[model samples]
Structures are given as C-alpha cells and as structure tokens.
Target: MEFSWLNWLYTAIAQVITWIHQAYSTFITPSSGLNWVLTIVTLTVLMRILIFPLFLKQMRSSKKMQELAPKVQELRKRYKDDKQRLNQEVMALYQGAGANPLGGCLPILAQFPIFISMFTVLNAIADPKRVSVFGMPADVVASAREAHIFSAGISDHFFSTQSVTSKIIIGFFVATSSLTTFLTVRQSVTRSIEQMPDNPMAQQQKILMYISPLFAFFSLNFPLGLILYWVTTNLWTLGQQHWYYSRHPMPKFDERGRLIPVEPKPGLLAKLRKSEPAPAEEPPPAKPEPKVVRNQPTRQPRSKRTGSKKS
Candidate 1:
C-alpha cells in the first residue's frame, strides 16, 4: 500500500478525536451527543493552541510590515530610479525587522492541511455505511455515527435531514461560523486601510470581507460534525483576534487615508532628563587679550627724504 500523507494526517486527527472522546466519555455518557460535541470542541481547542505560534508569527510579521511601511515608502521615493538598489534596501529593512513577506501567510498555509484532514476524517466517520476511511479504526467511525447534537445526527446535513430541529441546530452553527468569519475579514480590511490605504490588494480584501459569510452557506451540504468543528474554530479565531487587537490596537487612519502617528510615552531616559534640574549655565569664556599697536615714525617730505633715493 502506498504511504499517503493526507491519509496519515486524517488518521492522526481521528486518533486524537477518539482519545478525547474516550476521556470525555468517562463521566459523560459514552454514547451521548453532548460528549461527542464536547470532544470536537476540545479537539479544535487543542489544534488552535498548537497552531498559535504560527498565528503569532503571522501577526508579528504583519505588524512589522505595517511599522516599516513609511520607511518602505521613503525608500521607494529615495531610490525610485534604482530598482535593484530599492529591492536591496527593502530586503535589508525586512531583514532588520526580522519580518518576511511570506511570514503573514504561514498561519493560513498551516491551517489548510489540518482543516482538510479534520474535514475528511469527520466526513468519513459521519457516513452511516462507511468502509475503510483514512485508516481510522472501524469502532471509532461506528461510534461517531451514533452521536447527535440537539436531536440531529452528527452526520446530518441541513439539506439532507428532514427534521426541522436538525435544520435549526445546523443552521445556527452555519450562521455563527459564517458571521465570525465575516467579522474577522472585516476587521482585517479595516486595519489594511490604515496600514496601507493605497494598497491595490485592499480592494480584494474588501471583496472577501463581504463575501466570506456567503461561503458559510455551503455548510448546508457539510456534515454537522464538521460544521460544529468549524464553528468552534471560527469562534476561537474571532476571540483571539479580538483579544490581540484590544491590547495592541492597530493605528487609525485619517479621512484622507493617511496613518495617524501615535504619540509614544516618554521613555526612562526621557523621563530622567525631564525630571533632573537643568545644568548651571557656564560663565562666558574670558575674552582674548587685546593686541598692542606699535606706532610708526612720521616720514619727512619726499624732497627731504630724497637724500637716500636711487638715481
């Protein structure tokens, strides 16, 4: 059998979910839908915690770029005629800041594999008549099929299920998840305008901000378990971003789309300088000694002095 990396990832995620389910099932009912929902939530939390360093790096990269934007713009104007030099200078600035143009993308890139793996594993387990899937154990897959949240089967889809209760529960998750996604995008767009108002990419970011929520409607076709996982992850993202921004808020832009310079608090050195008494004014340096003028004897008339004149 070929060694499939994606399948391996799916198996790993499935195994973790199984372990979480087993732990939660100790006190909660082994077959309870609540236990399964809690299991998925716990799994999502763990994944987010594991990936937070990537998220932090991405955030730091973005912040560094934002801080360096004015300098980058200055460099562009200073070396507009020298493309090679400008590139060198920009690269130097990034290096000095320990920021990479690609760093902002790491979190997104890291999430794709995890997201796909979780989706695959859950979709497989959600199926009523599943064969071998992602190499996950048969018992684990079978156990998940019996789980339900709010009377809706864990595998039920909003459109596939006929029960109104199931639709409500699934719809609620879809709506909340989509709304959080939109809010996150919107927050990023606003910051982009402040950070790089003239950026052409801001328009595309705006388009995504408005349209992101629409993508959530596809949850109607996804398994309830997957949607639940998505909802938990989105909520986590929403909270994380909110907390970050609350502490390190992005600078605002003026109506003209210029970044507003924030006034920094005085540093320790500055405060000490301000608090210390002014140095005593030094006495003016003594003036240099006056030079004495020598008097020259007056000369007689030209005729009288002509005795020594040459012929």
Candidate 2:
C-alpha cells in the first residue's frame, strides 16, 4: 500500500514538473540553460505555495511545544531518576494537549518524496534516450540536454563532469545553500532561546544549529538543477521564517528557562483571530416538566362560629 501511494506521488510530481517545463518552453528559448533554471525556481515556488498550510501547522505546533517547555522541564527534574516514567509523562503531556512533538517535521517529511521525484526527473532529462514523459516532447528533451549554466550541464555533478565550469557551479551552490541554512537555523535558535532561556530543548537546538550547514555541504554532488531548487527553497524558508518570527515572537523565557510574565504581542494569525467574530454558542435544551400528582386531597373551611353564638 505504501509503495503504491509513493509511486502515485512520484508520478504526480513528474507530471507537474513536466508541465512546468513545457510551459516555460512555449515562450522562452528552450536551448538556453537559463530557461531550465527559471523553470526549476518556478516549480519550487509552486510547491511551496501548495505546502504552505503544512508550514502553518508546523509553526502552530512549535509554539505549542514551546508553551509546554516549562512543564517538560519540571517532568524531567521530577522524574530524573526514572527515565521510563519521565518518557511516559512526556508522552502523556503531549497527547493530552493534542500536540505532536514531531509536528514541525511534517512539512519537511512531506517534501521528501517531491524532492526525490524532481531529482529523478532531472536525471532522466539529462539523458537523451531516457528523456520521455507523458506529455514532454522530443524538442523539450533536446533542449534540456543543451541547457548549461556557466558552461556546466544542468544535470552535471562535481564528480561526473571534468569541466572547471561544473566545479564552479557546484561550489557556488554548496556555499550559498550551506550559508543560508546556517543563518536560518541560527536565527531560529536564537529567537527560541530568547523566548525560553532555560528551554530543555536548547541542547538539541544547539546541536542542530551546528550540524545543519554540514548536511547542506554534503549535498555538494547533487545535480546543479536540484541544488538550485534547494537554494531557492531554503531562501524562501529563510524569508518566511523571519517574517513569521517578527510578527509572532516566541514567548520570552528567563535565564533559568522559566517563562517571563510579559504580555505577548499578537502575531499575524493572532491578529486575524482577534479581528474575526466568535461563533455563537448553542442554547441549552429545556428541562422536562415534572409529572402532576393523581388524586390530591382538597381543603375545607371550619364550622365553629355557630357553636360560639349558642353559648
């Protein structure tokens, strides 16, 4: 079942990519490497737009996790000796609050298949014999093979190509991608620490802050087109996160990881919520009437006035 779903996903992604390439080919010179480059960037934009709701969910989940940090810390300290109990309590807390500790990872994980499919498509495009998709034409395939950036083929990798041009293009992609990733991670961690200085997750964030760039560098051998795709997406994430943080700063925390009691300024979403009217609550159902008693006794006036007059 999973394989079937994944196959469907890849097929769908291939269709979208091919459609975009064809659209670009209509007006742009297909022979120009710049045309393919622009197509990849445009594809990234469309994908981001589609997955934006996932991003919003991630943001909300992250904020919820942040809000629960203090409780998590308390759990850690309280159950420091019993690791099992600590784990149980943490899970319980997350579940009770309807939060997923891994919620923020949803968007990234969802994009994984799309990324792989794009890579596959680009690889196929580079090979003249294998460059056939449902709607892509022979002319587009020929054009893709001719597409070159800085004299390096769009699908060329550092290890596969002998040209200095390939090396330079790959190097530029690696450097920019790594740099942007580092900046994004650093900015995120710094803000998180500001909101909760004592955040128990600080250590994990610290590790990621250093390791993310390393991961980016490791992708140096990926196709120039894919690297370009990554660079564009990373740049988008960098800007989107910055905008989000500016509007909705994380809750501030003190040196000890305790939440500072300052009133939080509303974020973009919060402002929208504040502006909208609340839903009207439904009225409670009316209570049933009590049953009447059967055959109840009736009262009568006394006849003592005639006896007093006779006396």
Candidate 3:
C-alpha cells in the first residue's frame, strides 16, 4: 500500500506524541488525567523548541520590518497620489533591504499542519470506533481513548461531553487559550505601533486583536485535549514574547510618530566599568638631553676653509 507524504508527517507527529505519552504514563501514572495533560503541554514545548530557529527568523524579519517602517512611510508619502507607483517602490525597497513584510507568518503557518494532525490524532484516539492512522497501534489508540482528565475523557468537548465537570474544564481551557491569543496579538500590535506609530498595518492589527478572542466560540466544538494544547502553546508564546522583548526591545515612537530613543539598561560590561575606578593619569616623562658623541668628527673652522680656498 502506498502512503502519501501527509501520512508520513502524521506518523512522525504521532510517534512524538506517543513517546511523550508513554514517558509521562510511565513516570507519572499509567492512567492519570494530569499525565495526559502534561504530555500535551510537553508536546507543545517540544514543538516550540523544534521551531525555535523559525521563531528567531521571524523575530529578525519583524525587526527588519520595524526598522523599515520609516522608509516605508517615506515611500507612502512620496507617491501618495500614485498608488501603483508607491506599491512598486515599496516592493523595491523591501527587496533591496531583504525584508519580507510577511516573513513572521511563516512559523505560524508551518505550525498549522502539525496542529491539525495532532488534533486529528487525538480525536481518533478518543473515538474507539475511528480507525487508527499515522502508524499508531490499535492498543495504544484504545489506551488513549480511555485516558481521562478530571473524570472527563481527554476527547470530551463542551458540546459532546455529557458531564458538567468536563464542560466546565473545556470551557476554561478555551477561554484561557483565546484570552492569551488576544493578549499576544495585542502586545505584538502595540509594539508594532511603538516601532512605527503611523504603521499602515496598525488598523488591521486592531481588527485582529478584537476578532481573536471570538475564536473561543469556535473552539467550543474542539476536543478538550486540543484545547489544552492550544492554551499551553498560547501561554508559551506570551512568555516567550515577554522574555524576548525584555532583551531586544522594539523602537519606541511617540504620538507624533517620531522615534523615541530609550535609555538602555546597564549591561554586565557597563556595570563592571562603572564599578572600577579610573586609572591615575601618568605624568609626562622629561625629555632626554641629546647626547654628543665624544669622538665624532667636527666640522672644519669656516676661516681655515676660506684661507685654503684663497691659497
């Protein structure tokens, strides 16, 4: 039987999830709900770690975009009346600077497939009737199907789960996930504005910031396990951005759209330099007298030379 590349990808992700699940099951508890949740969270961490290089690239691209904002605005103003020309020039500028306006989206877009696969795998595992795919063993699938969190099966959804406890838990996860997503997007937009107060993307970002939280309503139908994964990932993004910005802050801009130069916090080297006393200035050394060589040939007297010339 032939398998597509998508099957291969699913199998790979399934292996990871299975490994994490097994490890957690062994160390924590064979059937503990918390273990399964931890497995999901750990899976998220591992996924984030694996994509860290992409995240770094995204950060670099975002920084470039921020730096290019002023130039972009200049181009906007220069060709305000000629939209087509302005777009051409802007594209040229971005190309010249090697800046991709949408480069930061690559990482997020890349994760979508993995997220979907994971969700599929979890949903399949939750439903015993569903045939197992992605090279997952039937026994493992059966075991996963039985896994419960807070007396609620991991596959339980707000609409599908019959228990009030499961519904409440799922609701909590959905709410937190959506809230974090909103905050993360909002923070990103705010930073973008600070980097370029008049950034044209600001309005779009505003729309996203408000619309993002509404995803909780959509997530209501998703399995609890998937919700947990999403919430965990969103929280991770929140912390990651916070830590990243602390070290590499965006350029701050005022209401007038002028770049505000923030005073940099003292680094270790700066602190050390400040702590150490300045070295005392050394006095200038006295100039050494020119030594006359004792046996050096002397010039003949001018008068003797004149007499010799006369003779």
Each model's lDDT comes to: 0.80, 0.79, 0.79
lDDT rank order: 1, 2, 3
lDDT value, residue 166 of candidate 3: 82
Task: Compute each candidate's TM-score over C-alphas.
Answer: 0.73, 0.74, 0.78
Per-residue alpha-carbon lDDT of candidate 3 for residues 29-81, written as tens digits (9 for 90 to 100): 65668778888889889888888888888888787777677778878889999
Question: Whole-model lDDT, candidate 2?
Answer: 0.79
TM-score of 3: 0.78
Kindly provide the TM-score of model 1 when superposed on the true structure, using C-alpha atoms: 0.73
- How many clashes show up in model 3? 0
| Winner on TM-score (2 vs 3) | 3
Worst 10 residues of 1 by lDDT: 248-257
Candidate 3 Cα errors over 4 Å, as ranges: 1-5, 130-133, 252-311
True-vs-predicted CA distance for residue 197, candidate 1, Å: 2.4
